[model samples]
Target: MLKTAAGGSFIIEDTTEVMTPDQLTDEQRMIADTTRDFIQGEVLPHDEQIEKLDYELTVDLIRKAGELGLLGADVPEQYNGLELDKVSSTLINEKLAKASSFALSVGAHVGIGTLPIVYFGTEEQKQRYLPDLAIGTKIAAYCLTEPSSGSDAQGAKANAVLSDDKSYYTLSGTKQFITNAGFADVFIVYAKVEGEHFSTFIVEREMEGVSIGPEEKKMGIKGSSTCPLILEDVKVPAENLLWEVGKGHLIAFNILNIGRFKLAAGSVGAAKETIELSAEYANERTQFGRPISSFPLVAKKLAEMNVKTYLLESMVYRTAGLMDEAMREMDNSKPDAGVVAAKAIAEYAIECSINKVFSSETLDSIADEGVQIHGGYGYIQEYKIERIYRDSRINRIFEGTNEINRLLIPGTLLKRAMKGQLPLMEKAQALQSELLSMVPGRKIEGTLEQEEHLIAMAKKMFLMAGGQAVQKYQMKLEQEQEILSHLADMMIQIYAIEGAFARTKQLIEKRGEDKATIAIAMTEIAVHEAFEKIEAWAKDILATMETGDMLRTQLSILKKLGRRTPVNLIAKKRHIAEKVAYASKYVV
Candidate 1:
């Protein structure tokens, strides 16, 4: 869905042609600098106090962020917002990671909280609520989670019955773990009207029978509010019905797509912060009469962390670029602007889920290693990495659980194939024929040729594994959760590898190979690791799905596709660690 305007080419067709962080415009760079400066000068100073569950301080900072237009990046200028591009907001989310618990408040307010109205609200709704939301005079919270429903969103028990006079709707239900519930002035609540059709309503804090429960003790992000929103006979004006009845799922799923992408961006920022902290700590703590950073194993951990961060950051900004390009040609003046925006976001749903899973898992691994790098200090709450470690745990559960997202990946692609929107079946069929007579190896040529070839083979692996699974299970593939997850893993690796490799190729074009040495090294390392994972997953799936002669034939073809010359990863990791250890941060 994030296709380029030129012939509507998807980034997967040619990632070198897509946007990268290095391709930021002057305005984007300026906004990025402003966000960084604000985080450093204002947010960081009170980070400690902010994490103590200080609601007033959190609200005040959000208003300050509003004053700087941080909360309005996705809003239209007519609504008194900055109306920045997707990349700009991605940068804002990345920068906000440094704010710790405070980041949660701001992200919730800016993303799911406020974006519903920005995209789906009618003219009167926008005029009435947006100006205040844009400048932080009012804070909005989304109410989709119910006590009995988590991943099964459609199973919500919230019910809203229309009044006889049709003047309002009476809402009664409990929304669990609602972000910003303690202080939110407005709520984007989802309920079924007439106990049948799913829908949404805009409920106000001041309405009768509206109440906020006591904050739940949380493992992390304590500075951000987390409380249940109780709606008992709460009357919402009929005009506050969002976009019409039975279309609430549109608002819920579309907003989540955007939320997943933003979460990935924030993870990139958090990962960088972890690396910097680990590097600094490694350099200061002496062991065996030398800093711990000098050890080969510690260096290996740092390099691995840095490589994952690079891959995640590359995929994230590339996605932001895709979204911005798609948004540019839309006619927002039309009344269906909200619907148009929802469609646009839904188009890239696969990419959003990919980033969410990759970014969350990436930060989790980095955080774990971060604790190891700090030894005993990492276990203590006095250490910031400890807090980061705790905070990162929730991201996997946010937007959508990683498990649900993993299944959604291949499921979505297959749906597109059936709908004639994607040529997945055709490509897989072609790959089956190509593998029948194709030779095993290719000669390496120019810069990044190996990585590029690896990415191509990985895509073929996904197609082959997924194709065979479909042929075997057909319509029942949805029930094969393990196979689906394996297919998703391959695709996730393909996306990350292609995105990172493309960005590296772009940098090489502009700065030459010698200057892009580190980027090249990181790309190659990630590509190799990802290829191995794809290989393992393919082998497992093929073995499980086939038998006897057919299994042997499939394994033979996989061997041809997986053939490659191995590199001395140990030396490269040490080289990467040397530079990061010297700079005490992730560079390039």
Candidate 2:
């Protein structure tokens, strides 16, 4: 087990070990290759048709994926699933991202749609639903967001009233923006029981009064089913109640933790494809008698894309490893293994939120640059980049908008601190005294050592700003959304940079420095760049909280902590880009 703080203390904890992609087992690599091949061979050929809203073809492809056992990595073997580790499930999402909207269909079916039952359903419910869902014989859809409820999911107006005879619950509501609604045979619907208790129920598509509205004309992922699911007094058996009534928020929020991480994995995969597309196009398209990829500007863009993708990949796997560790520590021989696993995933909710926000924004940037690299052709629907660009937009909006996620990051950490799950308050108080007498000059070591020190300083910056903000606002800190958002940005940067740094250090330790040169270079670049952003965010946040001499004192401390000699990032990026360009893909 890695020595780290529980809950969200990683922001203030020194990380030493993190799982990297280079450590993937042979079986995991084979799974990834198989997924890549399936997408390339089976899905890419029909990408055009799928993009044109060919629902049947999309459904067929999904069944084909299920036949290959791609859809049930997280489901148990007793349910006809592979019952693989969390990393395997993440790899599946990463590779499926190459399939575009088709990936969304599979993700919705396997993630939010079916996981509710897998994690929260009774044994009978699991037996009834998991087998079909595992094999893709019956598709599943999750209904939580309503027309009036999105980020505020618990505020849904949907209602379900139990019948007088206690045989069934009459559900009446409309769930909007439902993915997989068009073809899903099973629906996990959230409603207020008796129009008072918020709850979840499993409703079959064939149930009376259960109907789906017309397909939504979406901005992207057109092939994936998106529509409103209408439940008009639909009778759901008492047995269909998932988990406990009035505790539906537990299921809803916890499942989203896994969904957010998997979504980040998918974003990494999509960003990788975009990087490849951009690189291949840049290499083939010559300008002024040379390949445009040869230009410094284009090379920089490709390098930056590779860097962000690599960083996101590192964070995703690191979080997966943490979840795996948590799961491993549980006594699986017990009957509550599923609940244990769910709690394990929830333990890193802060990390999940960070992954979702960072990876989504990273993919959006990559998609935008990919379009720019292709110039006029990129804007046209005929090219893949245009669709990818559109598809990337929804990632930030869905799975909880990045704004909501941003707030959740710091907000959750503070809550955990108060709850004693993390020693954040203690660390903050200690750091406050240290700040009063802190010295400026400090000795630095090698590149990686310097990055590690910078990360520690970044954490201190977070504690200072966050601690002051809490004291200033007291109970009203939630209303200071702007400060919370800035703190979230700082935390996100710290996690990304620290994750990449820790992974690269482990790679170097295991493979020797010579073998990990590119990893070192990428880590150096990411750390330096992220530290700059952290400095700026700290300044902005402090300016909001304090002014005049108090502000000057805080700024001086932040400046000292952020002080570092800048490296030739352009040269490092050039070296990194050379490797990616030569391979015509994301080599790092």
Candidate 3:
């Protein structure tokens, strides 16, 4: 029954089989290696030039990537693409992160900019655009964020009106912070049709009245072009409309679902790079008559960086695997595979949001630690960590602010539960009665069994808190932003811990317990850390929602459910750090 539930149903379902790093196919590895080699050979050497806003060099690099078929993982083979699974696409993004700001350019072009057409375009539109865009002959940019609207994307005031002859639509608007706008040849612009119907249109740079403003300076990712798109009476043919009229939100939001997941993958890649940089710096930099890595504080930072990176990597691939599975179930004989895949990715909106928030934050922490490990040198632009830290901050702001994403995590779950897409209500009801008569504590057995138990209890805690909130507010639960945020935190922790736990369990099963020591330690560390947060958030939410005897009863249940023997993370972290320091890379 749980297996039949939709995406983000992992909160209730048993751990579904996932594709871990160890499970990458030979072909996938080849693709990853190609991407890595491309970055090292073509992009890294130009990092300095890229930082100087050399658009020509950046475009050349993108064209080189396209020549290698790196830009078309999500595009159909008929359109000169590899038509690879979501895993391959994720791998490409992850590897590209090594290029920093250039990665933003490629990600924008392939992900949000191009995916709209891949998923929502008509045959003629695809024929006209996909080949060139897929092969990097024509670059693409997504235009959804306007001068006046961002998080409230539907509030865009861009206007598109049909011509008297009905041959074209006259569009007028300014799209702000448009990635790749300076060099992009095609723009997937969102506007209101007849000044009322929100819709999407494919506008070209060559079109009359279409121009780009001067590039804006930014804190990071300067290599990627960011300019305001100016559209003044630009004539877009009616045939260029994407999806259905008034369904622009579908194109905007669904594409963003994939964008969020891809952003997570990119974050993982960036975080891993930061860890390697920090580890190497610690190994080379001397302090107190020894390498700084020999110092406990420095080692601890390295260990935390490695642990968070591993956790994020696990979740990013897990979500990608789930989307791939869903995509695989669709009938390829139909012409709607793109639409099906978009829907599949959209189904896991909560997971995507969680991955986006967690991975971005994790990367930021790793980047910050990387700088700290570099000492005073980190504050200078000469250090790579400084750029990484600056680049990492925007991930949380874009792809939906972490705050908006936090609200959506719980908000979307409730919507799905009410729609019977996720049997959350049924589980919540069952958990209610179970909690009422539940025993105080239960013994867990075997390797990582305690963590497994904690994960299950975390889910129960979420159900309990969410059910109470729903019961109290009924239809008005959206008003309680604070409670919703707490619930989101609980769900995020549950997903992260369980993702790590499941991946480690699978690894142990394949390689035996002795060989998975680092994984086991990492899993334990992540679960315990997440469980602590979940406990604090649960108490805060319950305290605000319930009082006196009721609060006491709920708190008692939470304590019993969340109870666990403390983990000696210092020892585990030391072990993890030792391994990473020796390898000078993220081993686990």
Question: Model 2: which residue pairs collide?
Answer: none
Summarize candidate 3's per-residue lDDT along 158-221 as a digit string, tens digits.
9999989988999999999999999999999999998899999999999999999999999998
Which is superior by lDDT, 1 or 2? 2
Whole-model lDDT values for every prediction: 0.89, 0.90, 0.90
Candidate 1: pairs in clash: none
- Give the per-residue lDDT digits (tens) of candidate 2, residues 1-588: 555347576787788888778789999999999999999999999988888878789888889999999988988888989988878788889999989999999999999999999888888999899998998989999999999999999999999988899889999999999999988999999999978888999999999999999998888888788999999889899999998889889999999998899999999899999999999999999999999999999999999999999899999999888887777666644667778778888999999999999999999999999999999999999888999999999999888999999999999998888888788888888998898787865678675878888888999999998888988997799999999999999999999999899889888888899988888999999999999988898899899989999999999888878878788899999998888889999976
- lDDT, candidate 2, equals 0.90
Candidate 3 or 1, higher lDDT = 3
lDDT of 2 at 64: 92
TM-score (all chains, Cα) for each model? 0.98, 0.98, 0.98
